[model samples]
Target: MTGSTTRLFAARLAGTSVFDPQGDQVGRVRDVVGMIRARGPVRVIGLVVEVPGRRRVFVPMTRVTSIDTGQVITTGLVNMRRFEQRGTETLLLAELLDRTVELADGSGPATIEDLGLDAVRSRDWQLTRLFVRRGTAPRGLAGRLRRRGDTLTIDVDAVVGGVLGLASPDADQGATNLLAAFEELKPTDLAEVIHELTPKRRREVAAALDDERLADVLEELPEDDQIEILSALEGGRAAHVLEEMQPDDAADLISELPAEQAERLMALMDPEEAEPVRRLLAYDDYTAGGLMTTDPVVLAPDATVAEALAHVRRSELNVPLATAVYVCRPPLETPTGRYLGTAHLQRLLREPPQTALGQLLDNDIDPLAPDETLQAVTRQLAAYNLVSLPVVDEDGHLLGAVTADDVLDHLLPEDWRDADEDDDLEGTSGKEAAGA
Candidate 1:
């Protein structure tokens, strides 16, 4: 009579009753939250439910006792607060419902009519399968997934799909066409969208972007997310993205991975690019050695201001918040040379271009020891009011440099990466309640 409920579509799950063990109605299913794993299928992490007084709460899949017959039963314990979507969370209703996606196992593409969810014997909720309409979806479905449905159920194994695009009132771009539109987005803004997509869709977009652009987006992501996205990409492609990243950022991501895994990724990179990261990996994550990037502009101490400026211009190094060039002695190659002193951009502007940089060097500016603690590094950056600080060994040889942005990444709140997303949406009017 109900058109077979073996696969419970999210559309139907929406507004369904959620009850406690005693059969007490707790709330209604508001949204489904999931974590996009680096490999394998995306996993259902929890559920967003709306209780009395219009409050949203997170109920982990593990806490869910059962889901069947248009009813969700939970363990009763619930945190009463509006659900704040983290950078890693994807709201099924908001991000995936009705989106066009390619069906797994060669079933062609289909509009994600609705997502089918089920509870296991252990009472953990998960995406058991998906429900899609097998028909020509509207072209250019950018932000919205679907407008209507035809009702076809597919098993979990047969449902691997990526975002074709959302069919929303705002934009009409298809899933395959999504990358170009996303390319035009600011890195932070694109980071938000990538945050809301599953790994498959994320990888699709990642592949579409050039190494430099993808590197920019990856830089804007959190360490965990940065690793996840990189992990999903092919080794060569991942290496290229890493090549484009600032040495410190790349090292930061690589350091989080297992040694063997890290080695494998590094192997695929260009030798010159790999050299700096390999050196960076030798430092403790909380130390200046670990925080510094080898991509800082470097010039021979004997070089003139013109040469120093030229070096900065010619090198495609993407150092963040960088405004200085390190003057080193002799070998101006990979794995570093003897550090002489630092020279800021302001110094270059004040001095004539032909002025020999060695004369203009600020050797009095204290250089950071590789083993210096993060606190010490922060203090130094703050005290000097410098955009970048050099890291050196006991011999005063330059190993790398840490930029102001790198310091902020460590000092800011855990959610700072996506906090601005909420800020951007603040003034815009939307009917959907905070978690609804």
Candidate 2:
């Protein structure tokens, strides 16, 4: 939903009602049947159409017209009479359902499951390959066959149709040679690959992936990596990705960039995303006020530990680094506002349900003031090894907390050094030197 490539996978239209060219109802899609590889143009295979009497028929993918949220539109009613049942030797639908396949060199494979695409050198789509179910090996002698022999020579279109009951037009180019080795990759694996790329390369890869996939990959990246990638994206796309990022992480990133750049990025982002960053930006960067996330999990001072746990479950996505739950008055404030002392999430989880946050609060907790420099902030953060250091004004009014990650960024150098150069004007007169 956040990145372009992810949107493709998340956009699957299965179970939608299929319609014919005349707009007559055909059947609902049971699943994505399969896809044809080695075909000139890649095509989707359709399968398992529910019919009258509770019967289901397998249909060729060629009959499909369009896929939408609730229904799949088809060109026409596939005359079931046209399809003859191949012998039992035919591959069963269950065998290929959600199965992963390696694309042969020079042939493209459409994903039966969602296919991830990566961009190489900023030109065209590079298929990252399919996500197949684990543990099941391909059946028959074909499983044992190596790169040689007729057994390895599968008719791509026929195999697709026979396996998933779909047909595809021939393709001009063959499947990508590099994709043949990767059967499937976990989201974390993909994130690591993205991490290895240069900033430009990362942008290319991110652009190729659908929104939801991009979001997953983004979530997996380290906070710093997320900042670099988002900074590289075009404004609109970057904004979309930021919208999907955890608010706390997103805020941290925006807080690091130059003020003008940060402001521009926030303006382009969706309001829900921009607001948190705006709140964060309002605080001084080196202080806890600037670094603390607004979305910390909090509970009323009087609430029982059981109620606190419930709040945590509901806010997990927003408050991942919830080292300690802050005990505050009713009505949670933005991190830039008031709060009380903190209680650890781990301790709360282990504590008795009847325990109140007020009883468990650590009275010795230290708070930070705004306008503190990076040098001082890092020292405190390092000394305490605190996951989150709360910030407050002179009046003891809470602002936000400085997160460990943000503090680390401030400690690191953001730019490369320039070679020092000396001018050779030692022998020149004062007037000459001034003129030069």
Candidate 3:
């Protein structure tokens, strides 16, 4: 499974085994690290290797004796410390794969498909070649079948600027290629990718994402990242993104900003969208009112099962919100008329479509008070085996619901969002690990 090979491509190096001089398996390559500059070959710094215990460590190119078939031979001396990328380092696969770069002499834009590294001297390597596909990726079947742009390998020097050009921080390195590459990733996973990028690049990517997508990603990101990305956007766009986020989540983030800045963003948001977030902001952070989302499933008691089902089936509704339908007396929106009871999806499904939600209301459990403590909320949810508990005011107006997820979010450590998930690393030779 190993032999010397001079020819190599950066994309091909991913997940290749790294062996010590005696052929003892040490780890597998997750990413190739390099220092890219404005107008020169990118210096290959090392390989990001995932050692046992799912720890990623740095193996300098000097320690690499051979880039071989199915494996890489190392000098055995490797830094076991977890690899923490310096601000200057670029992860070739994570940052450069599918990056848009301009071809020399204005031949137009091309996307980096792969990069080739060569040994220039004793124990030194440089990224000297780029394999690229010209133009934006094809779309429909015709676009896929029709003649696409040429794919070719050229000198690294032939490609200029964009993400590779660290010398120009403000240069508009569009995120088309980056977004295309990661389009399938979920919000949480995409947040992890964004977490590794430089501040400038992060801003570029954030600007490129649609407001709703950006909002979802922001909700999953660390607080600092959320603020940084939000701060980078124009005031109007930032407000729009806030409107897309869950009211409770948006309120939490806004509460962290300076009072003046928060007010400015709030003023820019549509009054209708700002109202729920503003209401959530007024509650204590750990109370039921603060943790609950103001946009839960709420309907008048006379609303038919079919009508409730239509709302529950909406693609935008989250799991906990869709699990039940709250029935009230008059108004249907949160903080509406007298709180009656809730109808779980199971009962809704079994009941006739024409049956009024009021007919199947489950009044067994008492609703939570708006000012209920977090401890009280948790006890209620646990005691009733409920995913969500309705919250109401003393005057009997239905407020919102506190879901299990919301409770878990507050119960976890403050840094829980920042901590990397311990995904099982049982299989080797897969896509690069997150944070690598």
- Winning candidate number (lDDT): 3
Q: Write the per-residue lDDT of candidate 3 for residues 43-70, one digit (tens) a residue.
A: 8999988665555677888778888778
Off by over 4 Å in 3: 1-83, 86-89, 97-128, 131-153, 159-170, 420-436
lDDT of 2 by residue, 146-254 (tens): 2221213233333334323323222221111111221144455556445544454455456555555567678667666777777766788777877776565577667
What TM-score number comes out for model 3?
0.73
| Candidate 1, position 214, lDDT | 86
In Å, residue 96's CA in model 3 sits off its true spot by 3.3
Model 2, stretches more than 4 Å misplaced?
1-189, 198-201, 208-235, 251-264, 313-320, 335-337, 382-385, 412-436
Winning candidate number (TM-score): 3
Give candidate 2's error at residue 243 in angstroms: 2.0
lDDT of 1 by residue, 49-167 (tens): 76554455677877776677778776666655456789766776656653555566675766655666654436444665666776545542222344444568776556453321221
Clash pairs of candidate 3?
Answer: none
